[model samples]
Target: MGVYNVHERLLVARSGEVGALLDTLSSGGDGDALWPHRSWPPMRLDRPLAPGAAGGHGPVRYTVTTYVPSAWVRFAFSGPRGFHGFHEYVVLPVDEERTVLRHTLAMNTGGPARLTWPLVWRPLHDALLEDSLDRAERACTGAVAHPARRGAYTRLLRRLLRRPPGVTGKP
Candidate 1:
């Protein structure tokens, strides 16, 4: 199965201001303002944001294959057995005081992922990206006009998939 997913938000901020968020992915600690670490697993890279840096949140794993500071970054999947392709975040300038922050996940699933992608991964991935965009909006404008809320099934899935305290795994 081939899966193509995208999530984006338009923020009333300069492109430079919104673009800087791209440089902060997986910085760890409290430095990453674009990922919603408070509600989801934090994205962690093996090294700083750059080509070849590896790591991912939860059970998914990928490696940074391309990066343009303050503009864009792409991560190619390397694990979970069946995911093949990349996910990327890009900043698009709409005007002097408007910017569109977009994330795209394009991949092909085989093996078990053929089932898991639609049943489990897709819901979680959608919610996570929405939360991520909420973070971006909040960081840029100090508020979110309309926050994304997880559905009942997604909440249940998260509860069921959450790792125990001190155990390293999906949220």
Candidate 2:
């Protein structure tokens, strides 16, 4: 299966201001203003934010393949068994005080991922990206006009996934 997902937000800030957020990924600790790490798994890189740096969140693993300072960064997936492709975050300048922060995930899934991608990963991925966008907007504008909320199914999945294998409910 081929999956292409995109999430974006338009911030009322300069491109330079918005783009600088790219540099803070995995480096800003708990105060990372762009990645929504408080709610989801934090992104971690073995080295600084540069090409060849490797790391990912949770089960998804990737290596930084391209980076253009505060403008763009791309990661090529290297694990989770069947995902092949790249995901990237790009900053586009719309005008003097408007910028678009976009994230794109394009990949092909084979083997078990063909099933897991749709039933398991997609929902979580969607929620995570929206939250990321909300963080970006809030960091740049002081607030989020509309915050992303996880659906009931997503909440249930998160709860179930958090439990240890062979452990069921309240023992």
Candidate 3:
């Protein structure tokens, strides 16, 4: 792998219970509620996802976008500029009820995207990965008790869930 390769893997949910969660992860996230009074705008979808892209390939593709609000958020990058990267997740069936999600994130620095991370983003990469995945777990947990979606929160969640990602819904 190239130095550009940075990864984070977490077993938050069982192999079987992660399908919907995987869908939500690859799709995007809603920050309005989480941020509440913060000025951070809603999470946007540069791309919407479809289901079935479970293996090396899926029946469809999904993609989502997010940005760090404060420069001090501490993550893949915690410097003057924030870190922005797109994540792809693949949801696979481990057993009847177990599904394995493999997540992969790609970020570019210095060379392009008008983006750059601190010189040692690798050290902090794992922490950021864990944080993002933990948040995803929270969303998935709510989906279980919550109705499919009844209000504005559900509306945004739906938007995120719809983007199944062309790649595995792992991340």
Candidate 4:
């Protein structure tokens, strides 16, 4: 099953500023000042963000398939068991004082992902992207005008992950 996911945020900075910050983050910089409040495994690339570069943590992995400085970037999945496709980030200038930062994921899930995606991955994915956008906004404007909030499902999942295995209260 193919999944197309998109998340965007309007920043007070121009495309160049926001794009530069994103580039820094993607390059594994020490700029925790603009850190995204991520609930999922953080992305770590083996090299700077560029074509053919590869990275990802946890159940996700991909290779940089396309890159355009200060504008856009694309990554093609190479792992995570059943993810086949790409994701990208684009910085669009709304005007000199505004920019739109968009992140898009287009991929087909197979094997267990078909089930895990809908039942588990989707919520986490959405939350992650929203947080990413929030971080981008903070990076540009020095504040998160509207921080991303996790839905009930995401909160519940977090609780479950913290539980001890085989400790189910019900028989």
Winning model by TM-score: 1
Clash pairs for candidate 4:
none
- Put the candidates in TM-score order, highest first: 1, 2, 4, 3
Q: Which structure among the candidates has the greatest lDDT?
A: 1
Off by over 4 Å in 2: 163-171
Residue-by-residue lDDT tens digits, candidate 2, 91-114: 999999999999999999999999
lDDT of 3 by residue, 19-107 (tens): 44443332333522221112212223333333222211112122322322210111132222333443444554555644444456554
Global lDDT for candidate 1?
Answer: 0.92
Worst 10 residues of 1 by lDDT: 162-171
TM-score of each: 0.96, 0.93, 0.37, 0.85
**Model 4 over residues 20-138: C-alpha lDDT tens digits?**
86676454435532335245555777887778788774557888898887788888998778888888888899999999999898989999889988888788778878877887887
Poorly placed runs, candidate 3 (over 4 Å): 4-17, 25-43, 50-87, 106-125, 139-171
Q: What is the C-alpha RMSD of each candidate to the true structure, in Å?
A: 1.3, 3.7, 14.6, 4.9
In TM-score terms, candidate 4 sits at: 0.85
Q: Model 2, residue 3: displacement in angstroms?
A: 1.0
> How many clashes does each candidate structure show, in the order listed?
0, 0, 24, 0
